[model samples]
Target: MTKPQIVWLRRDLRIEDQAALRAAAEAGPVIPVFVLDDETPGERRLGSASRWWLHGSLQELGDALNARGSRLILRRGSAAQVVSLLADEVGAGAIHTIRHYEPWWVKAEQDIAKRVDLVLHDGNYLLPPGCVVTGAGTPYRIFTPFYRAAMAHMPPPAPTSAPHFHAPARWPASDRLDDWKLRPTRPDWATGFVEVWTPGEAGATERLKDFLDVAAEYETTRNLPSQEGSSRLSPHLHWGEISPATVWHALDGRQGKGSESFRSELFWRDFAQNVITQFPDYPDRSFRPEFEKFRWRDPAKDENAKADLKAWRQGRTGYPIVDAGMRQLWRTGWMHNRVRMIAASFLIKHLLIDWRSGERWFWDTLVDADYGNNATNWQWVSGSGVDAALFTRIMAPLTQSAKFDAAEYIREWVPELADLTDEDIHDPPNRPRGYPDQLIGHREARERALSGYRAMKAS
Candidate 1:
């Protein structure tokens, strides 16, 4: 009688091209499990938007496992304890799982290693974090050098085929997914999400194929928020529904500026993981220690700051592009990358609010709210991370809107500006009715931000 091999699922939810899942199945009869371990990362636990995506992704995973004459064993508890208990119950010979970079996950893996023969494989990234580094054996602090070094490692491993598991004589006990309450019910703000995204391996595959067809134009059209120029694979990738290796291989040998540009963006994603792996506290703190001295406004202490934050969140900031991006994020659990920068800059620089505040909001709202990417990008916008944007380089939202030609995007999300002319969409000659007034003049805000940065330097 063959002993069961347990495949402990975390973010790597898919079967195809899954390193750990394939390795587990090849060992003997495979028993797959997903543990909802909220205890590992208390405050960093899955936010409402991520929970919504997880609910659907897990359902799809369960269905796929069932068709293969196996079913996913769902359990809720501390992962270290639950996985250890499961391994004992099944008398498993080995446990296989992909490497995860999240600080909590790092801890859980450490805890789980004591009980079973844990086999960690790489799947979540094109190359696992810490694999690429400077010639001096240190992780690259800047993206350009990192990108150059990472690309040389080139084209991740050729994806492996999905495995066919041999089932044990009897299946182990499992929990009902619905009992976990991963989705919301009181007010379904996620209703628009279903229309915009399909969170599963199959859906991700389809999206990848669709994007590849138009990928040749990605370089020119990606910045235009109204166009479907992007792969829209961030959520899928975040959940590991599709492995980065698969994406790399799919676009392999494809030639176009868009393909190259998209691949570079993937490099950026890898860069974020590299950053957070070395700096575990990257999510809540600045990478550059000097940024600790920077003066940032607090909504908790000032009424005006509080109101500015509220307007930014509610999409009434009176900046067309920024407001549209916020509203898009609210309605669909996603936002355009270009507008993400604009909106983040407005909050951090224009409003003088702490980038952490905007980071927390995005953490709660984005379906693809990855801690590494979220933290690294937020810090980049706020000029607080390594090789970050300079503090004085405050982006003018109005100029960015016109440069990117986001007028159509604004019209779609900020309907009050629907009647404005294309030329005036970015900056209306007069404030439209029902639209809130600009919270602060651009020049005044710029000067104030500069003054704050200077004060930090002097101090």
Candidate 2:
């Protein structure tokens, strides 16, 4: 009898298109393990919304494995230590898992490899982070060149089917998923998440199918938050319930601006990973050193800044578009992509608060909050990333709301403005009965943001 192979699960939760699971199944009897190691990540541990999603994703994954006559071993502790002990107990041949780029996970992988025969497979992104390089063989930092080079290798490998394997001779003791307390209990904040999301492989497949119907119109409709223009697959993709390769293959042979535009967005996800690989602290630190000196209103010491931050978080910011985005994010663990930029910009520029504040808030609130994507996007909006827009290019929230036809979107999230006409919905002429006043006028906020930029330059 061959020794059992251990498949260590992480974000890549699905059985299908899972390189590690496939490799393990091919070798011999399989033992699937999911270690909820919060200690390793320390401050970067899974946020509240992510933890809630994990409960559902893990439950579905365990059921799927059980249906195949396999068991998912659950444990909590230091990942490196847990895996090593499990390897000893099961007499595992080798440990297989998809590569993760988060700084903590990268370090954890290195430590685990030192103790066991750990084999890392590349299946998370379209391509491995460092695969696409410039003419000089260095990783491309900017997106356009990277996109062009990556496109040259378009249409990623076809997704593989789920494999079958024998179960371990004697299964180890596993923890009950419910005992983990992953979901909220007292004052349950995630009531809306259940209605909006389905957290498993089946759910991911359903979402992909729905997106296909509108994929041809994606280019025109993607920016419009009012309609179901977006794929709503970010949470699924983030959890690895669906693989990018699967998504790519699904979109294959569909010719149109929508498909082309959607593919670029996928590549952008890859770009974000490439960025974090180069700068592990990208989430915490600005790429440009000058930004280190940029004077942001510190909520810690400034009472006004603190109040503004609270208003932004609670979605009470008077800007209908910004408030709608924030409220939507709070109600559902997600937000429209276009509005995400607007809300983030309002926090960083209009409120003159640190981008890190908004990033941290989203990290806790969003089910799809990914470290790489979150940091890259926040830095991009703040003009502090290697590839970023100018700080001077302040976005006018009212103008953007009207331009993108977000009246319906606003109405759905901010019910206070629901009765307003399309003409007045974007920027209510007066304070509505229940709605708060604009946090700050667009022109004043833009000027303030630009002034801060000038101050950073002079400093």
Candidate 3:
């Protein structure tokens, strides 16, 4: 009777550079498992679009495991109970997994550790959260210092290779991917997603290769939504299909501004995790306490507020750039980072809605709707988090669109204005035929936002 070890998979979906999976394989027969435990994350559960991606990603992982003479066990239930029961039933010698930072995941880890030989490894981040800190022994609240401290560490650990062996003489019971109903079928909002993405390890590596080919232009191209300047690796990174270390090692010694810019973007992901690790309640609360006093319109309580939020979500805010960004998110399950900031600013400052409202919407919509990054970025935009942008700094959507040369982006998402010239794309002469009027004039909204900021400061 062989005692098989369990390799529990989470966001770290890929087999390559997988430390825990390899460790489990080295020890004994490995039972690779992915438990969809909705009970664990609770309020921070994966959104609809994310689930859709998960469905395809799991299919790929299963195929990859099969090719390697192993199998990926799929289970749905409370991970603590399900994993523990499986271990006991199989008489497993040990369970290996990567560490995760989500608050609920941390709780599950504690509960599972008490019941099993849970061996934890760190492979989710370029540098595991809290590893880079100030000399005073505290997490760096500012990204620049954190970036400097992290860079001083130089190249990350060499990526571990995927294990080349079979796992378990007989596979355990697994759930069927299709039966889970992870993807929406009735409305099929994700129909566009297939055209834009391939959700697995192979897709991740291919995206990296594409980005590196033009890595030198990344700095300039990343800002222009029209160009394929951005890496578009957020979803893959969020799902752990590709490890940050693998991304880092790929760009190692690559001399170019684009590679350097892209590397900093990766660091920001790690920084968000660091912030969340230091402040567990970060998703719901602000890093700066005074932000609690800041007046935020409750869309749930007021019908008028609700209408504004609906318009923002549907991309009918009369602001061409904001509408374009919102529509892009609905169609593709992703948005350009520059437009994300502009749209976020419009909701927080222009609409006077609470950042949490926008955060929740993004949580439900983005394929890469990460709890840590979403919280950090929303707060950063709203001036509520550590090293946040000033609340007074309201982003003018029209100006942003013009500066980023988003005419092509607007035309792609907002077809109503596709016929307009470059000058008219960001702002039409008198509200184009089919387009809605601006929610509020840009100058008026800016003044209103400043008033709200002043009142918050005065209070």
Candidate 4:
């Protein structure tokens, strides 16, 4: 009997197109393990929304494995320590896992390698991060050139089907899924999430199939919040329930601006990973150094700033579009991409809050929250990233609301404004009875943001 090969699971939860699982199954008896190593990520541990998704996803994966004459071993501790102990218990030969680039995961991988024959494979991204590079042989910092270069390697290799698992003679003890308490119970804020999302590989496949029908119209309808124009596959992709290659190949040969645009968004995911690979601390710090000196209201020190931050989080910021987006995020664990920008801008520029504060909020709230993507987006909106918009270009939420025709979306999320006319919904000529007034006048906020930018430059 060949020694059992341990396949360590992380974000790559699905069996299909999972290189590590495939390799392990082929090698010998496979023992698949998922360690709930909260200590590894420290402050970056899975958030409440993410924890809810994980419970469902893990249950689905465990059942799938059981159906295939195997089981998903659940343990809680440091991943390196758990895997080492498990390997010893099962007399496993080698540990297999997909490569991950998060700073903490990278450190965990290195630590695990020291204790076992750890084999890593790449299947998470369309192409591995550092594989695409400039003529100078260094990674490209900008997106446009990187996208052009990466296009040459378009359509990643066909994804492999789930491999047959040869079971071991004896199984190890495992923890019950219910015992983990991953889902919220006190007040149960995630009731809406259960209605909006399905958090498994099957759910991911269904979402892709649904997106294919509208993929051709993506470019035109994507920005309109009222329309289901976006794919809504972020959480699935972030969890690696569906591989990027699977999505790319699914849309292969489809002709339309929408298909092209959607594919570009996928590439952007790859681009974000490449960024964090080069800059591990990208999440907590500004990519542009001078912006560090820029004055931002500290909620801890200022009561007014604290109150404003509280209102923003509660979706009472008074700008219908911004409030709607934040509320949508609270209810659904996700937000429309266009509105995400508007809401983020309102916080960073309008409230004069540090972008990090908003980033941390999204990190805790979003089911699809990814360290690289979250930080990159917030920094981009704050004009503090390497490839960021000018700090002077503060977004006017009212203008954006009307321009994007978000009246219907606002109505759905902000019911107080539901009775308002299409003409009055976006700006709400008079404050609705229940809705709060605008946090700050758009013009006043814009000028203040610009003045702050100028001061930063002068300093």
Model 3 C-alpha lDDT per residue in residues 123-196, reported as the tens digit of each score: 88888988887999999999899999999876888988888765677778999988999999898999889999
Worst 10 residues of 3 by lDDT: 163-172
Reference-based TM-score of each model: 0.98, 0.99, 0.98, 0.99
For model 3 the local lDDT of residue 171 reads 78
lDDT, model 3, position 208:
92
Look at candidate 2 and tell me the lDDT of residue 188.
96
For model 2, residues 1-459, the per-residue Cα lDDT tens digits are: 899999999999999999999999999999999999889998889999999999999999999988988988899999989998999999999999999999999998999999999999988899998888999999988999999999888678999999987987889889899989999999999999998999989899999999999999999999999999989999899999999999998988899899989989998889999999999999999999999999999999999999999999999989999999998999899999999999998999999999999999999999998999999999999999979988888999999999999999999999988899999999888878979987788888889989999999999
lDDT (0 to 1) per candidate: 0.91, 0.93, 0.90, 0.93
The runs of at least 3 residues in candidate 2 whose Cα sits more than 4 Å from the true structure, single-residue gaps closed, are: none
Error of 3 at 251 (Å): 1.7
Q: Give the residue spans of candidate 4 off by over 4 A.
A: none
Q: Which digits, one per residue and each the tens of the lDDT, describe model 4 over residues 117-154? A: 99999999999999999999999888899999999997
Alpha carbon lDDT at 237, candidate 3 = 95
